[model samples]
Target: MKHALILVALLGLSVTAVAQTVREPDGYRMDQYRGPVPDSLTGGRVLDPEAAHDLWQAGEAAFIDVLPRAPKPKNLPEGTIWRDKPRHSIPGAIWLPNVGYGAIAEVTADYFRRGLEQATDGNMDHPVVIFCLAECWMSWNAAKRALEYGYSEVYWMPDGTDGWTFFDYPTEVITPEPEP
Candidate 1:
């Protein structure tokens, strides 16, 4: 009986350790951009697909897709053709690729700020929905950054286009806003 109790205690400790390791970080996620995400954001609402859909139908929110663009290889042979990957996102969403990384360059930061200003028409109170792919940390980082930028109404749709399309919601191909 003592041995059985010790085994149960060890299992409990293992579960607790795993849970701790998976908790959300205090700051941006520095790496592993794709993985499970927390269910909440400190200064923004964490939205599910249904909630995002409702917001979309309301026409009062601006959806921003932050899926990163894959840059062309610099090592490709001269004359080798390279094509950019196509991305499909929720209709009417503004694609601001590469602006969601945990750490961003000054130019990228300017682009993100400018994109937000354009999306909200310079209204900080306008509702902004930020996303990328499902289980992507880029959205989380971007949402937090939006909050820091004094956006009063920010929503983080962690499931992003994956969740959006799962319900047969329509999507459209979008080009990223040019970086400054």
Candidate 2:
């Protein structure tokens, strides 16, 4: 038991160090999110792909994809066929668009809070992982929001889904339902 506890503590420290050292990729804009992000969220930690994969395989976390759903392009001369690009994410990640990606509106915030409650069955201690595209701020905002909502184990996957797939991690296609 002591050894396990020690190992966990060391991992926590390592994650913190990694988070602090992470630099935003070139061309990342702060104006993108237009929301405050603290240096750290008390119980939330930043995770690399390996750490995220471990949690995923172990079923120890709820993975959330905060990437916004692409809007259908406007303007068609007549009948130009439009097809969506393939939608894929780390296996089992829930697609929760609009949960983050700028200052969250009140309605969307309420919806996200409720959805999160249902997702975790109201268990605040359930581990939750939030992610989006590499260098995207959406995942950062969502992860911080989860922490603010009292989730004890929030993980921000800064490397995003593409990073996971880049490493040859298995991915699953997810078809999001149309919102009413």
C-alpha lDDT score of every prediction, in listed order: 0.90, 0.74
Off by over 4 Å in 2: 1-30, 33-42, 74-78, 177-180
lDDT of 2 by residue, 36-141 (tens): 3333434579888999999999998888888777778888667888887777898777777877754667877777777677667789898888888776777877
Q: What is candidate 2's TM-score against the reference? A: 0.73
Weakest ten-residue segment in model 2 by summed lDDT: 22-31
List ranges where model 1 is wrong by over 4 Å.
1-21
* Residue lDDT tens for model 1, 29-129: 88999987888899799899889999999998999999999998889998999988888988999999988899999889889999999999999999999
For each candidate, how many residue pairs have backbone atoms clashing (under 3 Å)? Answer: 0, 0
The total number of steric clashes, by the backbone 3 Å criterion, in model 1 comes to 0
Who wins the lDDT comparison? Answer: 1
TM-scores of all candidate predictions against the true structure:
0.87, 0.73
